[model samples]
Target chain A: MLSPILEFFSSDPKDKKLKKAVEHIIGQKPSNIMLYRLAFMHSSVSKETVAKGYKESNERLEFLGDSVLGMITAEYLFKKFPFKDEGFLTEIRSRMVSRESLNGVARKIGLDKLVEYDGNRRTVLARTSMYGDALEALIGAIYLDKGFQFTRKFIVKSILTQHFDIDTVVSNNPNFKSLVIEWAQREGKQIRFDISEEGAKHNKEFTATIYVDDDSFAVGQGYSKKKAEQTAAMKACEKLEIS
Target chain B: MLSPILEFFSSDPKDKKLKKAVEHIIGQKPSNIMLYRLAFMHSSVSKETVAKGYKESNERLEFLGDSVLGMITAEYLFKKFPFKDEGFLTEIRSRMVSRESLNGVARKIGLDKLVEYDGNRRTVLARTSMYGDALEALIGAIYLDKGFQFTRKFIVKSILTQHFDIDTVVSNNPNFKSLVIEWAQREGKQIRFDISEEGAKHNKEFTATIYVDDDSFAVGQGYSKKKAEQTAAMKACEKLEIS
Candidate 1:
């Protein structure tokens, strides 16, 4: 049933390599070669195709895959932790799908070898987690090629089960923002965070200052606002002895 | 096959009303009546069941449904606007799934009549978008009960094409943030926004101040930081005359 489609991709050596890599990673022969090709085509390598104000790269696929990943993960956690509340489920899901986690998983699954991008370390794309983004795009490709049910099974059986241990993820979730909020709610204290972005667009940094009961306690900085806020919250938690 | 399930729900008058209402809105009989019932159970009314420090309400389903809605909408927009970039697709999707839009759609579908909640205007839930939240939860219920394809068809056919006009939605999208960012990118200018939250949690408002080249250009306020930023961006656009 699949020999004809397999032969189409195997005709060329380069296509054979992609087909083999994708098949090895996703555990299935890709029906659509174009989608799999596009999934790995990072924006850094496609800067010229900006006629529509956006590069013809994997970004759109990333957006779609991100949502698919979220839904699948949410449902997984929702069912797996039936008695657990939304907060706990959300934390675990976030841990499982964090950029760091995705990048790690993508590298472990050899996606970094398939991802096409500018290799220069100074490039903004190189600095960011393009591998993770590629992984998401690949998932999007799988979804579009094989439909939602197949994608869900692949994600659950292949990605989640193979790559992540729920117990470990739950214990390792570094969500200080959620922690601080929970603490504030318990202590009946007012908590807020003020985030400011600075530096150039390529090297933008976010500084988050956390306040409790209108008093600034700690400040932290990171590449993103969420990370900065988490750092700030972690510091606040430490200061308030909220372990 | 469905008669047995229909008979199961039709036994109770209230359940029958709910069954009829949900069937009317979704254009299908719900197999899982419990999921549909849980979809309309607002947090305000479920505060008593806080064993896990979170109320047993539609929130978890809402979270699940939000991702499902996002993925469906993203795919829909991606396929619909083949020539448009991710930014345009994102803006349109945001417009389509905005709190105001969801609330309007839910009311139009008569979900307001079925949704169970405290009707007191003074309650925070009443002031906020519980209707929109319920709509999302309902989508979650549909996805869980009938699966993704059915939910996607229902959304596209019953909700998107029925309640929303694509052309009008595209033309009327209030995305001043995108406009200002585009202008800044074109003119090689620096533009940034600082958002601050004020007042109590229940009545909190976000004030977004737009800055161009380190100088504050304009400020706007709204219930959400995104809205406030959009308002500020609109004012900045008016002053800069980019449009």
Candidate 2:
């Protein structure tokens, strides 16, 4: 059933420069061939050519892979940092999976070299974060070809443990929301942000106060109550640091 | 770490009568132990006991498992019904993963008999649907413990291939949102819901209209515009019988 799709990979000969570049980036020989093809398949390529009758582009795989990546990352962070609370875990994962980080990885991996497109000039802007998404789609393919355990190991060994520093990265770039949530949880606190007045109907300003076990910690204002609380909580964290 | 947890499982054992009844229903010995256990762990259980100090609940795992399940089911449906389009593939997947269908599976497996509780019986309703969530959680656990290949095989053999009659099921159950989206995609339709209306400043009512190549297919009303559009889309699907 997948023979035609498999043929697409073998028929398209890899350029020497592209192969070396991919080897340097991926840190391993491309074990599963389908993933490499998927990484290069731009939406610009006619969908009919990619899969026999698959209608949508790699968007669905990207979505699926994004969630898978998230789960594996979350689990990794959870086990790695045993003492870290949910807020900390969430922040770290967010940082790891953020568009900026993924794009950086994509660029580092030189994914831009492998992408197949119709026009060279027009495809310049196409190389941006779409490469990161393509990278994830490739990961999804690897996961399908090789099992999850192998994929998980490959992700950690090849990507995270090899390229990134876990502790320094997390400690230096703390998520404000996570810090506040962790502090609250640690102190057995209950915080609520009540928007007493929104200045305008269309574009409203919200006032939020952080409560630690019903006592007000700090108050802040923002366009949204969530933002306001986050600001308030950040201020409280600062205050606690001083105290 | 798991001894205390295992005690909870051993406390009730499986009610002999219920076991016999389930065996009669399933026509086989339930080989998947972790899956059954996962189907029983309600969110109500203290987070400390589940993963130890981490608030690592089943929610994240459920989210990941849901996507995996969705993709696998879509692939199955796509191959099984070669004549069906993208819309048909999507609707069948939705039907397979719907909360109601999962809940039904939970009932069939007698998962309700295995749940551990602290006996907060008054406010919280302990229904079989919770088992569906646990089922997803268990898949997460299996992915962790066994691997994705095992999980995939378990799902295919135990659930999809054996239990579900795909043709009859898909023909009977049609997902409205999926139908509308597919129809829009195929017809080269551009649809947007104009939600400019603001009611009583704070409160808002949104009206949504479905446009198929600039023609309105249906109109829907709701508290939020996104909701309204979804409702309208659903209505359009019903009217057109797009599924």
Candidate 3:
């Protein structure tokens, strides 16, 4: 532990910055800063390794971290809802580990700030998934640096249980269509969702409009009818102030 | 350990049958027959536990086993391909854990004979997935009954390495369209896939026809254009003996 502090003064500016970032993200001092460094190394700037292989990027780490996340989440669900059916377990698990949820977690942990990448304009535009991918790679690094038991505790106590609100996640249906329909049914109000397709045969767009009691509530467009309905329902939910 | 053998001889006929099946599947003596029994019990015949909850079917076990499978597969891939990129790892992992692969593994393990489910005509149609689910549940039961190490050995040695042909799997592309296109390009043959939509708007269908050298080679159908193309490509591969 003292080594890190001692090295802090002697370490280069970049190393010091990385150490700080690692400390902030994990809430624990990093024992293997190299692994953490690799975790933040994006594939965009991937170099060659000694073995003529590409310099390791967060992708491999992301793969392992994804499994670790799934296992930990499954264990949590098994214990938390002992009597719940598999459907409930699967639904809750999906909510907890969804891309949107992970993106939020990544933002909260400031992973976007830590990532190192070199990219072109098109690549940069496609890197909306970078933060979440970095977060998973961080987890894989932690698992390797800290071991499985420590990683499990770190994730359960610090990440999932600490950062995410369980109640809100459970109650908040990402399937906005289902939520709005339930709300409409409870109030005995008529609700209709109309979806239409437009554009050329190869590149088509779907538009969905929601009507509540004969009043146009919201309109949304997407590449698919389901996505369009979801978008429209989300807008309707925002307008009506219903979860 | 001897208790299982004694119980097999003196127990009810059903318990005897279950024990026999369990032994056949795991290639070991049954230390706890109850867990194995639950592993094979489908939700269709679900009863009530003392807690008034639906007597746990293989669902929870399957959930746990799915994670176990993923983790084990990740570890295997990590060790097997030290320098391989994440994309390679992900593709192989998906291939190994795919439903078709799992179902094939389940069938090889004779899960078709062991699972006990009470179902009507419609439910029976869905039993195609039951065999694979039971196989996963059985894995979960082993993890609990024996330990992680033993479960790992069971999966890696008894199931994956022993039964699966790694070389064939690696060479075979699940993307039939890609495989067929590559073959067509090498052979200097012109090929085209034409897809059309059919059926009701909501319950839509897509059909695809593959033409090689301006002659119809194969026809296939699916719910989506991409799937239909894939189906047609698969048929073309079969007919042309191309992949």
- Maximum-TM-score candidate: 1
TM-score of 3: 0.65
In the range B1-243, model 3's lDDT, one tens digit per residue, is 346457545677888888788877677877788778888887666655655534567888898888888887887887788787675676677778877788889988888788877645236436467878888889888877876667888889877897678777777767889888898898799988888886456445578998888978788765568767877887676555554
Q: Model 2's DockQ?
A: 0.13
TM-score of chain B of each: 0.69, 0.57, 0.65
Q: List each model's interface RMSD.
A: 5.0, 8.1, 5.9
Off by over 4 Å in 1: A1-10, A47-54, A121-124, A173-243, B1-10, B47-54, B120-123, B173-243
Q: For model 1, how does the per-residue alpha-carbon lDDT over A1-243 read when each residue is reduced to its tens digit? A: 335457555667777789889898777898887788889987656543425333577878887898889889999988887666554676578778988889999889888889887665336555578999999999999999999989999899888999998788777756678889898898698988999986555545578998889877679765578777877886676555454
Regions more than 4 Å wrong, model 3? A1-13, A16-31, A50-55, A119-127, A174-243, B1-33, B48-55, B119-127, B175-243
Candidate maximizing lDDT: 1
Question: Mind giving the per-residue lDDT tens digits that candidate 3 earns over A1-243?
Answer: 335456545567888789888887677889878788888887665555655534567878989898888888887887787787665576688778877778888888788788887645336435467778888889889988887777888889877898778888778666779889999999799999998886556445578999989877789765568767877887777556565
What's the CA error at residue A68 for candidate 3, in Å?
1.2
lDDT of 1 at A60: 80
Prediction 2: B-chain TM-score: 0.57
What's the true lDDT of residue B142 in model 3? 86
Per-residue lDDT of A53-102 in model 2, one digit per residue for the tens?
A: 44334544555466557767766775686555444565577678777678
lDDT of 2 at A239: 57
